[model samples]
Target: MIVRNCNRCGAAITFVRTKKGKAMPCDAQAMPYRVAPGGPVNIMKPDGELVRGYWLESGTGDGVGYRPHWASCRTP
Candidate 1:
């Protein structure tokens, strides 16, 4: 994982390569989430696998994954 700061928001992030060999910046930490079809948020695995789901903040999750940094970025 390549750790760095966001140029727009300054939040720490890690880059995960996608299946297309593209780097996707994600939050530094992994979060648990439940599968939610057509969800607004996404989760990225260490291996670059991504899933659309809702975060299980106070609830049990189906799996753990990293959140896409752009989804929560402060600056547009």
Candidate 2:
């Protein structure tokens, strides 16, 4: 999946990878998801870099950060 961002208004545009690494449109276009940290996750314009990885806690004291990009968003 990919999250593309809007350069003019900072809106997030989400996309999912298809059969050949092609990103296709999805629900995020109508209702872009916002981040818990007061902002939203999005992909960089032109290059479409990931803005932040979104993850929901499974249980208490999960203490993630196992993968290098796991906690790519915040210090959760």
Candidate 3:
């Protein structure tokens, strides 16, 4: 599993490799990542290399605004 922070929301998104070798978001509450047929979505990394994976955008459909970022969790 690979964990990456959302660019818009900074949420820690967990990605799992499928049996077919495709990366998929594992969080149930996360917005569905659109998978383009025939190829993976291209995301530009900080180092200028291109990466293929599911990307999530920030902001709600309603007028209300949501801050993008994963909520920090505490383990008991």
Q: Please, what are the lDDT tens digits per residue for candidate 1 over residues 1-76?
A: 5689999999999988888899999989878788787987888866777878788876557877888898889984
- lDDT tens digits by residue: candidate 2, 25-74: 43343222223333334322223323343333453221221211221323
Candidate 2 least-lDDT 10 residues = 62-71
Name model 1 segments beyond 4 Å from true.
58-60
Point out where model 2 deviates above 4 Å: 1-4, 25-76
Give the top-scoring candidate (lDDT).
1
- Quote the positional error of residue 30 for candidate 2 in Å: 6.8
CA lDDT, candidate 1, residue 40: 74
For candidate 2, the per-residue lDDT at 9 reads 42
What global local distance difference test value does model 3 have?
0.39
Per-residue error (Å), model 2, residue 34: 26
Query: What is candidate 3's lDDT per residue for 17-56, written digit by digit as tens?
Result: 4445655543324342333334344432322233445555
1 or 3: which has the higher lDDT? 1
* RMSD to truth, every model: 2.0, 13.5, 11.9
Q: Each model's C-alpha lDDT?
A: 0.83, 0.35, 0.39
